[model samples]
Target: MNPDIVRWSYAAASGALLALAFPPYSVWPAAVLAPALLLRAMRRAETPQQAGDLGALAGFLFAALSMPWLRFVFGPFAAGLWAFFALGPALFGVLLKRLQGRGDWLWVAAAGVLWAGMEAARAHLPGLACPWLSLGYAFAPAGPLLQAASVIGLYGLSAAAVAGGAALALAAEGKRIPAGALAIVAGLAWGLGERRLELKPQGRPVSVALVQDESYDVERLAAMTPRDAELVVWPEYQAGVPGGMVDRYREHLAGLTSGRKGVLVVGAATVDEQAPFENFAWVLGSDGALLGRHDKQHPIPFMEGRLKGHSDPRPVATPLGPVGVQICYDLDFEDGSRRLASRGARILAVPNLDPASWGPLQHSQHSGMAPLRAVETGLWVAKAASSGDSMLIDPRGRVTARLGFAGRGVARGTALLSDGGLTPYVAWGWLVVPLSLLALAAAVADALFGALRERAFLVYPPSPLGVEAES
Candidate 1:
C-alpha cells in the first residue's frame, strides 16, 4: 500500500479508538480500540522509520480530535501545539517497535519514556496546558488501576497504560515474554488502585453541597439583582461585578444570609485602591457577617486575574472548613491544589467561570479532570462553574453527583473531609516533577547504553589497531 494511504489509515484508526476517552462516554471502546490500532501499527512497521511515521500519523489525528477545543485557548496556537504533541506518541510507538526486536520490556520502557515526556511537555507548552486526555482516565472509574498516580503522579499511570498497549501488540505477534511481563505490570497497577480506594488516614465523612450556578449575563445581573437562597454558593465571576460591587451586592447576598441557617460561600470580585481587584470566595454567616474569605489564588490566564499574581493559593478561616478557592484554569495545576489542601482544607472548592470554548471536545476534556484532582489529592473536589460541571468528586476520583451545563442546581453528596488530614501528595506536591526528571534521566541512560551495545554510538573507543599504532 502507498505510504500516504498507510498514514491516513493510522490517523483514522487512532482517532476512532479514542471514542470513549471523554466523559458520559464509557471506555470499553478505548480499551479494545486503542490497543487494536497500536497492534496494527506495530505489525505494519517493517523499519523503525516506517513505525515512527505510522506513530506520527496516529499522534496527529489524536491531537486534532482530542484537543480541537484548544483553538479557543489561543487560536491557531492550539493546533500548532497539538501538532507538536502528536509527534511524541508517534515517535514513542516507532521507537518501541524498533526496540521490540531486542525485548518486550525494552519496548514498553522506551514507549513509556516517549509518552510520559510528551505529557510533561504538554504541561510546559500547550495553552493553560491541560493533559486531560491521558489514557489512565479511560479507566478512571476502575479505582484499582488509578492508585499508581498517588506515588508516581499521572505519568506513572500513563506509562502503565502505554505498557498495556505495547503488551497487546507483542501478544498479538506471539511474543510471549513481553506479553507476560506487561500483564504483570498491569495487574500491579490495578492492585494498587484497588487498595487505595478505601485506604484513608482520616476515615470519616463530611456533608458538602456543590452549587452549580451555570453561566449568567453580567448585563442582566447588573440590571436586576438575584433572589436569595439558603446556604448559598455562587460560581466564580458570577457573584459580583468586576469592580467594587461588593457593597452594592451585599443587600442581595444579605437576603440569602439573614434568613439562612448556615454559611454562604460567594464567589465574587473584591477590590482595593492598594492593588487591583482580586477574585475572592467570601464566606458569610447566616446573620450576614463576613466569616472568612479565601482569595482565589490561581486565576485564568487572560480572562480574570493575571497568572503571574495569582498562581499561589491563599486560604482563609471558615467555620464549615478551611475554605480553599481557585478560579478556572487554576485546577489544571497540582501545586495550587496542594497549597489549598495543605492549609487544613478538607474540601476543594473551585468557583469556575467557563466561557463558551472553541470546540465541543474541549468541554468534555475539561470535565475529565474532576476525577483526577479528587484521586491525586484524596480530597473531595467541588467544582462550581458559572457554566457547568458543578459536581462533587469523592476522594477516590468518582463523581458522586454532578450538575449539567447551564443549570441552576445544587449537587449534594457525602464528601468525607480529612479527619487526620493531608495525603503525601498534598504534602509532597509534584515532588514527582523532579523525580520524573530523574526517571527520564535513567531512561535516557538506558537508551544510550543500548546505542553503545548496538554500535550506533559514533565514537567507538579507539580501535585495537589504532591503539597499537599509537603505542
Candidate 2:
C-alpha cells in the first residue's frame, strides 16, 4: 500500500473506533484502539504539520460521528463545530511529534499528558468549551473502572486511557517493557477501584423521585410526584415559568409536598429587574417556603437564550440534607459539582433538559456523565431529564435506577446522603490539569532545546577527530 494511503486509512480508522466507543454503540475497547491507531498514523508523518493534519482528520471524523445530534440544533452548521473541536487533537499530534525520541516510556508519558492538557484546554476555552466524548467516559459503563474517577476525576481517567493507548501503540512496535509497565499500572488501578466498590457507603438513605415529562406542565408533574419520597425533582425549564410567575408556581408546586416531608426541586427560569432570564432551579420546602435557588451556571452558549449565572453553587439546606442542584449543562463541567462537594453537599439533584428532537443518543451520552459526577463527589446523583434517561447514580458510579429515553414517567430510587468528607477528586483532583500543563511545558522546552543544539552543531561542525573545525 502507498504510505500516504496507509497513514490516512489509520487516521480514519482511529476516528471511527473512537466514535464507537461512546453511546449508543459504546464499544469500550474501541476507545483504546482509537488513539493507538492515531499515534501510528502520526508516526508515519515526515513533518509536524502532516502529523497535525492527520490528527485533525481523525478528530473531525470522531466529532462528526459521535456528535451528529448537533445537527438537530445547528443544521449544516454543525460541521463547523466539529472542525473547531478538531483543533485539540491537531495540537496533540503536533506536541506528540515534537516530544518523540525521548525514551519510549517518557514519550508515552508525554503523549498522555499532552493529550490530557489539550482536552483540559478545549474544555475551558473562553466561549466554546465542549467536553463531550472525552476518552474517560468510554469507561463509564464499567462500574469498577469508573470508581477511579473518585480519586482522580475525569481528566485523570482521560490521561490513563490515552497513556494506555500510547503504550499499546509502542507494544505493537515490538516495545514490550513500557507497555507492560503501563498495563500493570492499569491493572492496579482497576484492582483498587474494585476494592473501593466493596466498601460500604456511609450516609443517610433517602427516597428520591425524578419526574420526567416533556410537557413541563406543573399540574401534571405535581400529580406524578411520589408522596413518600424525601426529595422530588423536576427536569430543567419545567414550565419555563416566567420571572413574574415564579412565586405563583412555587406556591402551587409546593402542593406536591403537602402531606409529605419531602423537598421539591423544580427547574424553571428567573429574571431580575435588570438582567435577562437566568436558568434557575428552585428548592421548595414542604410548607411552600423557598429554601434556596441555584441558577444554571454554565448555560449552553448560543443555543440557550438565558443569561449565565454568576452565583457560587452551594447546597441548599433541606430537611433531608444539604441538596446541591446542577442544571443540565452545569454537570458537564467539574467546577460546580466539585465546589458543592467540597462545601459539604450531601446529595446532588440535577435537572436536565434534552429534547426528543435531539435524539436518544444525545440523552444517553449526556446521562453517562452522571455516573462520573457521582463517583467524583461521593454523592448520590438524582438526575431528572426532560424527555428521558432520568436516573439515580450511587457514589460508586453505579446506575441504581433509571427511566429510558423518550419516556414520560417518574424514576424512583433511594439516594444515600453523604455525611462524609469530600472525595479525593473533589479535594485534590484539580492538580491533574495543572500538573499536566507543567509536564507539557517541560516536554516542549526539551524539544526546543534539542532543536536549538542541533542547529548550533550544524552551524559549527566538529572535526572527525573530535576537535572543532577552524573558521
Against the true structure, what is every candidate's RMSD? 5.2, 2.9
Residue 343's lDDT within candidate 2 is 84
* lDDT of each residue in 1-471, candidate 1, tens digit only: 895576458556875576455554656337435745664676576766677677676667766766666677878777776677666666565545556666557766666656666566555543345455666566665677665656555666666666666667667677777668767866776777777776753544555565665445433332222223323456776664435556566666665335455556667764444557677777776676787666655444345534234555665565556656666666765667777777776667777766544333555556676666776776778776665777777777778877766555676666665546566677675665566555555655665677677675456654689788889
Residues 53-142 of candidate 2 have per-residue lDDT tens digits of 999999999999999999999999999999997898897887788767768887787788888888877777767766788788888987
| Residue 446, model 2: Cα distance from true site in angstroms | 6.7
> How high a TM-score does candidate 2 get?
0.92
Each model's C-alpha lDDT? 0.62, 0.84
Candidate that would win on lDDT: 2
* Stretch of 10 with least lDDT, candidate 1: 222-231
